[model samples]
Target: MSLPRYQEYKNSGVAWLGNIPRHWEAVFLKRVIKAIDSGVSVNSIDTPAEENELGVLKTSCVYRGEFDPSENKAVIPEEHDRLACPVRAGTVIVSRMNTPELVGAAGVVRQNIDNLFLPDRLWQVHFKDAVPAYVHYWCQTPIYRAQVQSACAGTSSSMQNLSQDEFRRFVLALPPIREQSAIATFLDRETAKIDGLIAQQEKLIALLAEKRQATISHAITKGLNPAAPMKDSGVAWLGEVPAHWRVGKIQNFAKRESGHTPSRQHPEWWENCTIPWFTLADVWQLRTDNVKFVYETKELVSELGLANSSARLLPAGTVMLSRTASVGYSAIMGCDMATTQDFINWVCKPELTSDFLLYVLRGMRTEFDRLMMGSTHQTIYMPDVAKLMMGLPPIEEQAFIVSFLDTEITRLDALTAEATRGIALLKERRSALISAAVTGKIDVRLS
Candidate 1:
C-alpha cells in the first residue's frame, strides 16, 4: 500500500521531517502559529448547572482530534484572564497535559461552539497563514508524536506535561496553503470511507452480542428440550419455565456478602498489604471480550486494611455482580480476592453452581437495567437484587446448560475476535494514509 513519491526531494535537515518535496519548506510550528496560549484554570463539576454557562473542556476533547462540546466540565465562571478566551472556527487546540502517547494530540475547531472554556492543560493556537486542518493532520503523525514524547516531562509515569516552548519548535514539512487544503479535502473523503467500514463492523459486534445473550437467556429459563412441560414462574423477565424447575430468590440458595475499603488516612491500614482489593475498574477489565476469570486486581491492600474494613477474601468459585456504577456486570473469581462495596458477592450453594448463576446474571442484565431506569444513577439496590427470581433445574441439567453455553459462546467469540482485528487493521491503515499524505510521502494535490 505504499504511495507514489514526489518528483524530486531534498533533505529537510531534520530527523523527523525527513526528505520533503523539493518545492516545499520545512519550518517550525512557531513559524506558522500566530498565537498560542493555555486555557483558564477552574474547578470542574461532573454535571454542569446549565448547558449555556461557561464550561471547561477536558484534554480528551483534543486528544481524539475532534471537538465534542459534550465532554465539558461545568465551571461557573470562565475568567476573562484565561478562561473566557473566545474559541472560533479553525482554531487548533492541543492538549498540554495528558499521557505521553496523547499529550500533544491536536484538533481544529470546525464550528463556533458556545459557553465552553479551555482548561490550563489545553492550548488553543491560531496559525498565521497555514491551514488549521493541515496542522491538525501533522499532529496525527508519528513524527509529531515522537517529538512530543521526547519533550514531555513528568514525575509520575501515569501523567505527562508537554513543554510548550519545545512543542512550538516542532518541525513539519509544508506545501503551499492551497495544496494543504486540497490534501485535507482528499483525506476527508478517504477517511470517511474507512470510518464507514469500521462502523459496520461495530454494529455487527453489537448484533452478535445480542444473539449470544438471547441464547443464554433461553437456555437458562427453559431446558434444552423445548417440548418439556412449562409452568408459570411468576416473574416478568422469566415468564414460564419447566414445571419441575425450582424458582426462588437468589438469597435462598446463595450466601450474599459485600466488601469495603479501609480508611486512606490510616497508613497502618494500607502501607504493607498483600491482599488483592478489587475496584470497579477491575470489574471492567474482566468484562472485556474473552475475559472469563478475574484472578487478580489492580491494587492490593494491607492485612490491617482487610481486618479494619468489611473486606473478606472469597474462595475462587464466588460470583460477583457490580451493584453500583456499571450495574449488572458480573464475573467469577479465578482466585482468592476481596472486593469493594460496589459489588454484591454470592457464594453459590451446592444446589446452585457459580457458572449457572453467572450466566443467569449475565443474561438478565437488560431486566436489571429496565428496573433501575428511573434512578439518577443506575444502581441495583441489594434488597431488589435479593428479590430477583431465577428458575433452576436439577444440578446435572444446570451443568449441561453451562457447558453448552461455554462452547457456543466461545465459537461466537472467535468470529468477534476476527472482526475486531479487521477493525484494528483498518484504523492503522487510516492513520498511516493520513501520515503519508501530510508528510509529503504522497502528493494529494492531484487526488
Candidate 2:
C-alpha cells in the first residue's frame, strides 16, 4: 500500500512511524535532551529502615509511563548523601539495564516524594523544551524499542545494558512543545479506552477458563446423574460427590511410571533413534499436535537402557502429567510418545477409559502437589502419585461424564477465543490512532 505524500517526506525510513510534519526536524536524542546517570545506587538499602525517608526507586518500579512506588526499595545508607540527582516531577526515567524487550521502558516522574533517588541502572532525561510526556510516549513506540534492542549488548541469560552515551545517540523526530502536548493528550485518552476494552476481554477470558475447569471437574467426579445421593468427600476444594462413588488410590486403576535421558555424548547411540523424546517445552501447550524431534527404533534398542526406556512410548490412551517446573499440567496422549524423567505416564487399566482418566487427573492436580517431595523444586515421586486416593464410579457413568464435558467445554473455549480476538483488534486501533495523531495525519490541535 502507498503511504500519503506528506507521510513520504517525514518518513525517517522507520516502518513503525511512516512520517512526521513538514515543519518538524529529526535529530539525535543527545542533541535535544541531556542524559544524567544519577549515580545513586540502591544496593545497601535496609528493609527495616525508617519509613519517613524517601524510598529508593529500583529498575522494576519504573514501567511503561508510571512510577509504581509500592515496588520501590529503601535507600541505601552510604549513597543517601550523594542523592544530588534527585528526580523531580516531570523528569523522564528510562531503564538502561534490563532484558532486551524491557530495556528503554520509560516512565514519567509526575509526582514528587521527599528524598526520592534514582538508581544507577536508570537514565534520567531532561528535555530542552519538548514535553516529557511526549518523550515518554515516543520511547514506548515500536521504532524506539527496536533501536534500544539493537543498542543492548550481552551474552548471558540477562541482556546487558546501554550507557547514557548510547541513549543520547538515539534518533527521533521533534515537534513543537504545543504539538507535543496535543499529541500526548490525544494518546492518553485514546489508549485508556483501548486498555479498558483489553482489560474487560482479559477478565472474560479468565472467567471462561474457570468455568471450563469447573464444568469438567463436576462431570468427571459427580457423574451425569444429578439426582444421585451425594456424600462429603472430606476435601474442602471438592465439597461433596455422588454417594455411590468409591474413593481409592489412583494406582488402583492406572500404572504410574517415570522416564530417563540417554547420554547425549554418544552420537552413534543418540542418532537414528526412532523413539520420540519429550521435554518440558513439549508440554507447554495442552494440545500435542506437534513435537520438536524424534528418535529411531534401532538407536533405542542398541544404546538406550531401561531407564532411558522410561520414556517408552505408551498407547494413545495414556495420560501424561508434568512432575516439575510447571507442575500438575496433564494431557492425554493423542498418539504414542516418550517423555523425560520429569514426567509420570499413567496408563489406564482396561476397566477405565483414558478420556475419563484424563479428566480425573485434571481434577486431582491440586492433590498431586500436596503429595510432592523435594525442597527447592517440588516433585511428585512414583510412589506418592501411585498412592493418590481418588473416588471412582462405574464404567458406564465414566463414559457419560466424558461425552457431556467434551460438548460443554468446547463451547466455552469458542467464546473465550472470540473475546480474545476482539481485545487484540482494539489494541491495533489504539496504536494506529497514536501514530496518526503524533505525525499530524489527524490534527488534534484546536484552532
Candidate 3:
C-alpha cells in the first residue's frame, strides 16, 4: 500500500536525515534524553535466572526493535549487590558494546522486569520528552543505523563500543508526541502482521523438515514396500525391519575408522597442504549447501601432515560422521580425503553401500539424541558408536531408497526455499516501512 507524504518538508542538514516534515525538528538525542544509565558488570552463570532470582541481561537481550528477557544470565549470590539499573518499563535498552553490526541495537521494554538487571554492555535510556516506542522504532531505521556505524569506536573489528556521549550527539528527526504515537502504533500493527506471516513460513519450513526426516527414516528402515512383512530388530530404537533384512552392528558391514590431527607444534607437518581435510568447520557447509557428498572442505592438510598423524587417506565414497562437538551429521567423501578426529569414518565393505549407511545415520536423529552425552560438548563415545546397529536392506532396495529420497528431498527443498524467500521479502518490507515512517519519507498518521 502506498503511504501519503507530508504536505511540506524542510532540509534537516544531516546527510542521513535529508529532510523532515516542516514542523518536525532535527535535534540531538541529548536534548530529549534525561540520562543514559549503565548497569555494573556482574559475575553470573550461563543459565537464565528463575523468577525469584536476580539476573543480568546479556548483550543479546536487545536486537533490532526486539527484546528478549530470556537472554539473561543468573547473577551469582556473591555478586547480587552489583545488580544495579533494574530493567524498567518504558525504557529503551541499547547495546553499548557488541559486534560491529549489533553495537547500537535497541529495544524498548513493554513491562517492568523486577528481577532482571542490565549489564555493562547495555545502556538504559531515560527519555525526557521522546516516546520510548517511537525512539525504539527510529533506532531500527537505516538512518539511525548509519549514524551508529559512524559513531561506533573500537580498535578491534569484532567488537565496538558506542559511548553515551556519541549516542547523545546522534540526531533524531523528531515529530510531535501525538504524531510519534501514531507512527509507533501504525508500525506496531503493520510489523506484527508481517511477523505473523513470517511465523507461518517458519512453521512450514519446520514441518517440511520433519516430514523429510520421517520419509527418510521410514524408507531406510521399512523399505519402499508397504506390504513387506516385518520382524523385531532386537535393538529397541530399530523397532522393526523388513522380514528379509538383517539387523546387526554396523561395524559388521563397514570397517570403522578414526582420524587424527597432526601436531600443531610441528609446523613442518602442516606445510605443503594438499589433501582435503574434513573438520567441524566444514560441517556447516554440508548442512547449508544440503549436499549428500562432500568434495570440498574449509581446510586442507599436507601429505606430510597425514603421514605423521593417525589420519588416513580414505577412498572416495567413504562415509564420514561427525562424532564430537557437532554430532550426527554424516556425508560421503566425494574424493580421497583425510579428516580430523571429530569424525568417525567408515569404509563400506562389499555387502553395504556407503550411501545406505549415510541414510541410516541421517535418519537416526532420535537415536543420536539418546546416545549423545556431555554437558558443554556432546559426544557419541567410541564404545557406543562401535556397537551401533542398523537395518540391512538388499543392495537393489538400498539404491531404490536413495534414488527415491533424492527426488522427494529435492521437491521438499524447493518448497522450503520458496517459503524462506517469502519470509525474507516480508522482513525487507517491514524494515522499509519502518525506515520510511520514522524518517518522514512517508506519513503514517492516517496509514
Model 3 regions lying over 4 Å from their true place:
none
Cα-based TM-score, every candidate = 0.83, 0.83, 0.96
- Find the candidate with the highest TM-score and give its number: 3
Worst 10 residues of 2 by lDDT: 289-298
The global C-alpha lDDT for each of the candidates, from Candidate 1 onward, is 0.83, 0.69, 0.89
lDDT, model 3: 0.89
lDDT of 2 at 90: 74
Please, what are the lDDT tens digits per residue for candidate 2 over residues 1-447?
Answer: 122323435565655555767777677887768546564565555452355765667777676445565556666666577665666777788887787667778877777655566777777778777788877777766667777876775534476687777788887777788888877886787688788888999999899878877787777667788799999877554568899887666778888767666667665656555655567666565432121112222124223533444456666667778887767777776656666787887788877777777777777655766877777887777776666666778888888787787778778878987997998898678767655665556656652
Name the candidate that leads on lDDT: 3
Error of 2 at 1 (Å): 21
Q: How far is candidate 2 from the true structure (C-alpha RMSD, Å)?
A: 4.6
